[model samples]
Target: MAVVGLPPMGCLPIVITLNSPHGLKQRGCLDSYSSVARNYNKILQNELQFMHNSLAMFGARISYVDIYEPLMEMIQGPKKFGFDKIFNGCCGTGYLETSFLCNPLSYTCPDATKYMFWDSIHPTEKTYYYLFKNTLPILDFLLKD
Candidate 1:
C-alpha cells in the first residue's frame, strides 16, 4: 500500500461554480417549468452539501464558495450592475448553442469586453477577470490561517 500526501488546504483553491440555465429558469414555485432539471439541481445541491460536510467531518479542512448565488443575483438585477443582457450569450448564432465552438472560424462577439459570455458555456476573459476581481474577498478568507 502507498500513502499519498495531500496538499494543505490553505495552499489550494477550491472553487465550485454552478451554471444551470434550466435550474434558474425553474426557480421557485413547484411547477414553473422543467421539473426534471429542477429536481436534478435540488438533488445535486443536497449531494454537494453532504459531500462538503462529510469531507469536513474527516478532518479535511475545506472552503465552500458559492458562485451561483452571486451570479444569479446579478442576472436577476442586471441593471444594478450596468449589464443589460443576461439571457443571450455574446458568442454563437445558432438555435442550440452548436455554433459557439472555440475555433478560429467560429463566430464570436465583436467586442468581448462588452459582453458577459465568450461562448455558449463559458465566459470571456473579461468576464473571468471580473469574476476573479470580485472573488478577492473569498480568496482572502480561504488563504487566511
Candidate 2:
C-alpha cells in the first residue's frame, strides 16, 4: 500500500485569491497555509512509519509517496513540464469559479494542456499525468514485494 501526501493547497487559485493581502495583486500562496500542510504531511509520515513497523511481522510493505515536493516543483516551474498556466484553471476566468460556477455555458480555454488546474479545486489531466508518471517508481517498488 502506498499513501500519497497532500499537494500545496495554499497555491491553489481559490485559496490564493481568498487569502492574499488586501492590496496585493499578485495573489501568491499563503506561507501559513503551506506550513500547515507541511506539518500534516510530517504527522502522516510518522504515523505511516509506525504502522509499517508494527506490521512488519505480518510481511506488510507500506510505502509513503511524497507528492508535495514534485507538485511544488511543477507549480513553481510549470514551463519545464510544458505547462503555461500554473496559477489558474482552464474554466472561465480561472480564479474563484469552479463546479457550478464553471458550467457548460462558461468559457473554457482552447488548450487545457497549458493549464495545471481544471477548476479551482481540481487538477487538469496533464497535471494528473505528471503526478502519475512521477509515482510510477514508487508503485513499482511497492509491487515488487
Candidate 3:
C-alpha cells in the first residue's frame, strides 16, 4: 500500500482567490497555507514511517508517496510537462467557480489538457496523469515481493 501526500493546497485556485490580497492578480502560492500543508505532510510522513516500521514484523509493506514536490515542480514549470496554465482551472474563469458554478452553462476552456486544474478545487486529467506517473516508482516498490 502507498499513502499519497496532499498537493499544495495554497496553490489551488479557490484558495488563492480566497486567501490572496490581490485575489486573481496574485502570482504563486500563499506562503501561510503552503506552510500549513508542509507541516501536515511532515507529520503524515512520520506517522507513515512509524506504521511501516511497526507493521514490518507482520510483513506489511507500506510506502509513502510524496506528491508535493512533483506537483509543485509542474506548477512552477508547466511548459516542461506540456501544460500551459498552472494557476487557474479550465472551467469558467478558473478562479472562484466550481462544482455547480462550473456547470454546462459555464465557460470552459477549449483545451483542458493545457490547464493544471479542471475546476477551482480539482485537478485536470493532465495534472492527475503527471501525479500518477510520478507515483509509479513508489507503487512499484510497495508491490515488490
Candidate 4:
C-alpha cells in the first residue's frame, strides 16, 4: 500500500497578501458583521503597503492601475449607451435578487436586455459591454510594458 501526504500550504501567505486592503467593496459586503470585515479595508491597505515596500526593498518597479475613476465615470456621467439606466436590475426581486433569490423561483425583470444589473450582485451583459468599452484606457495602461 502507498501512503499519501498532504500538500504544503503555499496558498496561506498569498491569501493574506491578496486579502489586504485595496479599498474596493462588493455590494452587500458593507453590511457584513464579521470582525474581519470591519478591519478588512485597513488590513488590505496595510498589506498593499507591505507589498509595495517589499518590492522597493528588492528594487523592482511597481505601478498602480486606477480603474475606479473610469468605472465611476461610466456609472455617473453621460456615456454613449444606456443613458437612462440608474436603479434596479434585470433579474430577481427587491434587493437580494442576485443568484441567491433570483434563481429558479423568484421573478426576474421582464426585459433583461435593457437593464444594468442582471441580478443584484452582477452587471447585465449590456452593462458589462458599456463598462468594458469605457475601461479600455485603464486596461491598456495596466497591460502596457
Winning model by lDDT = 3
lDDT of 4 by residue, 56-124 (tens): 676543333332333344455534455344334565542445556677777876677655556644666
The digit string of per-residue lDDT tens for model 2 on 14-117 reads: 88877777413685667788888889999999999999999989988888888788879998888999999887789987888888998889999999999989
On TM-score, the leading prediction is 3
**Pick by TM-score: 2 or 3, better one:** 3
Q: After aligning candidate 2 to the native by TM-score, how far in Å is the CA of 84 from where it should be?
A: 1.4
Q: Which stretches of candidate 1 lie over 4 Å from their true place?
A: 1-60, 98-100
Residue 16 in candidate 4 has what lDDT?
Answer: 21
lDDT of 1 at 114: 59
Where's the lowest-lDDT run of ten residues in candidate 4?
A: 1-10
- Looking at model 4, the pairs that clash are 20-44, 21-44, 21-45
Residues 27-98, model 3: lDDT tens digits: 578878888888899999999999999999999988888888998999888899888888888999898899
Give the whole-model CA lDDT for all candidates, comma-separated. 0.45, 0.85, 0.88, 0.44
Which is the better candidate, 1 or 2, if ranked by TM-score?
A: 2
Q: Estimate candidate 2's alpha-carbon lDDT, on a 0 to 1 scale.
A: 0.85
Go through the candidates in order and give the clash count of each.
0, 0, 0, 3
Order of quality (lDDT): 3, 2, 1, 4
Better of 3 and 4 by TM-score: 3
